[model samples]
Target: MEAKSERAERAAQNELLFRAVNEQILQMTERFRAQLSDIDIVCECAVASCVGTIRITAEEFVRIRRETGTFFVLAGHEDTDVEDVVGRRNGYVVVRKQAVAADA
Candidate 1:
């Protein structure tokens, strides 16, 4: 239905915005060479109102970023209708947007 596509589009836009923010965070972290044991980054969820943070190491984030269009979110924050869980860590999970499913 049209409503579902609209929801998916909205979710994609929100997630993309968060992903861009997270990329900036990573750039800052790498530029400073902070060597932090763990960094608190915003949850890359689709919820526009979500202000949650997920704790993860710089290296871990880089590893997850190796894949295109992936996001890191809190375990229960993932919306299966929009993304597919690709990896799971202690407190977070990596997800990839499902092209067909999300648009369906």
Candidate 2:
């Protein structure tokens, strides 16, 4: 079993990676303002092996960015022990990592 701290570290790293991908996608999307619609974003789950992507509208992504602790993951990717489901969409779920993990 993974230790709590290790899990938190992994989760934090995944979140950071997801954020980086999001930023890249945002930059690319900005160049096509007239065609902007649903954007593909990396699933920000703690699972290091996960390579899934979630599609969300640009507005939804902006709302998630308003809060640092929140993340968008595939519908079933949430680790209940380290995060809580704050919202649900058609193909994805919004999770807010626990304080300890969120701060990592």
Candidate 3:
């Protein structure tokens, strides 16, 4: 039936979209990993939350983080934590810089 064919077509299109999004995320994550290899990397959803080790300076990190995205609806509000958003969306890789401990 025409209806059945239409539904199938829609499903296929949706699948393709999903695949594209997944690929984008994978690519971005890989780039982040490579760029911040000196630090730990955690792939997380914007809501679920994760951590990564970052060797870059705080200024650099802040700049990179700001450039990440201007809009994050999944984060639920303005000034939402990037880690939280990445965790919720499961669409971004976060690079966290671990705090160094002072020697005793």
lDDT of each: 0.84, 0.85, 0.32
lDDT of residue 97 for candidate 2: 77
Kindly list the per-residue Cα lDDT of model 1 for residues 6-28, writing each as its tens digit: 87788889988998898899887
RMSD of 2: 2.4
Q: What is the lDDT of candidate 1?
A: 0.84
Q: Provide TM-scores for the models.
A: 0.85, 0.89, 0.29
Task: Give the runs in model 3 whose Cα sits over 4 Å from its true position.
Answer: 32-104
Give candidate 2's TM-score. Answer: 0.89
Candidate that would win on TM-score: 2
Question: Which candidate do you rate higher for TM-score, 2 or 3?
Answer: 2
- Tell me how far the alpha carbon of residue 19 in candidate 3 is from the true structure, in angstroms, after superposition: 0.9
Score candidate 1 by TM-score against the native. Answer: 0.85
Tell me, what's the RMSD of every candidate?
3.0, 2.4, 16.0
Off by over 4 Å in 1: 100-104
Q: What's the number of clashes in each of the models? A: 0, 0, 18
- Per-residue CA lDDT of model 3 for 19-104, tens digit only, reads 34444544565556645433322222232222322132323333444533221221232122221223232333332211111111
